[model samples]
Target: MASIAEVKAQIEQAKQSSQQAMRAVQMLNNQLDQAIQQITAASQGTQHPKVQQSLVALQQAKQKASEVQASIAGGVRSATEYAAQL
Candidate 1:
């Protein structure tokens, strides 16, 4: 069995990992947003390939970002609570 100190350390590590993952997701989402904005601005009402790709990226990111954030939050919360109880 792990000691309380070890468990607390692991919890901290898990929290850090979650934070890193959240930052990565945020960065990717920001990129997607920028791509969409730029594509939309320069599209000029044409069926441009870049605009289509950006729209798909925006859709995919919208679908996944919420799930990613919620999972990160839940994991971090669970780790912290478990450590606190130790």
Candidate 2:
């Protein structure tokens, strides 16, 4: 059985790891945005079906990434609250 302090430390570590993963997801989302922009620019006012689909896919991915980040943040907040109680 772990002491309160040890359990708190473990929770904190998990929180940090989750935060790091959130950051990485954010970075990937940024890159996806860049790709979308580049594709739009390359299209130069042409309505390409494939390009439109690609853009939509990227946008969806960004939205999902944002949700993931929010979820992770919530988890971290919960962990912090639990640690405070400890």
Candidate 3:
């Protein structure tokens, strides 16, 4: 029921939001990477199971964030394509 212009505007808004989300996710991942590095450095020459687990957990979280960011980028691309067709 909406006009093409309105739909295009909505799509643009969604794309922008997706971009922002992607940036946020990327920032979080960077922080996670830094944390992982710090933990590794602090635990050098030590064999702590809990520290190992923490590193694994942080790595997994970073991976998941990367996946989420990729998904958001895909959505933004799709929205841009759809808007172009309008």
Candidate 4:
């Protein structure tokens, strides 16, 4: 049987974790946007094939990161709700 204090602590931890995940997601999104802009600029001129491939890879990574972020956000929300119930 968990005490009220323990439950509260868990809730606070979950909140902190969620906030961290959100920040990470935001950073990744910004990086992805920058990478896209760079790729676009390179494409306009004499761009190397390797650069284009790298950009594609970056885009894919960004997509994956977004998915992970969504999962984290969902977990955070669920934890919050559970904590409130406690």
lDDT of each: 0.85, 0.92, 0.90, 0.86
Weakest 10 consecutive residues of candidate 1 by summed lDDT? 48-57
Q: 37-77, model 4: which lDDT tens digit per residue?
A: 98888678757888888888988988898898888888888
What's the true lDDT of residue 59 in model 4?
89
Sort by lDDT, best first: what order?
A: 2, 3, 4, 1
| Candidate 2 ranges with C-alpha deviation above 4 Å | none
TM per candidate comes to 0.82, 0.95, 0.94, 0.81
> Model 2, range 28-79, lDDT digits (tens) per residue?
9889989999999999788989988998999999999999989999999999
lDDT of 3: 0.90
Compared to the true structure, candidate 4 yields what TM-score? Answer: 0.81
In model 1, where do residues sit more than 4 Å from their true spots?
A: 47-57
lDDT per residue (tens digit) for residues 1-86 in model 1: 99889889988988998999999988887877887787788886889786787788787886799789889999898888888888
C-alpha lDDT of residue 10 in model 3: 88
In angstroms, the error of model 3 at 25 is 0.4
* Count of backbone collisions in candidate 1: 0
Please give the TM-score that candidate 2 achieves against the real structure. Answer: 0.95
Better of 2 and 3 by TM-score: 2
| Number of the top-ranking candidate, with lDDT as the measure | 2
Error in Å for residue 16 of model 1 = 0.6
For candidate 3, the clash count comes to 0
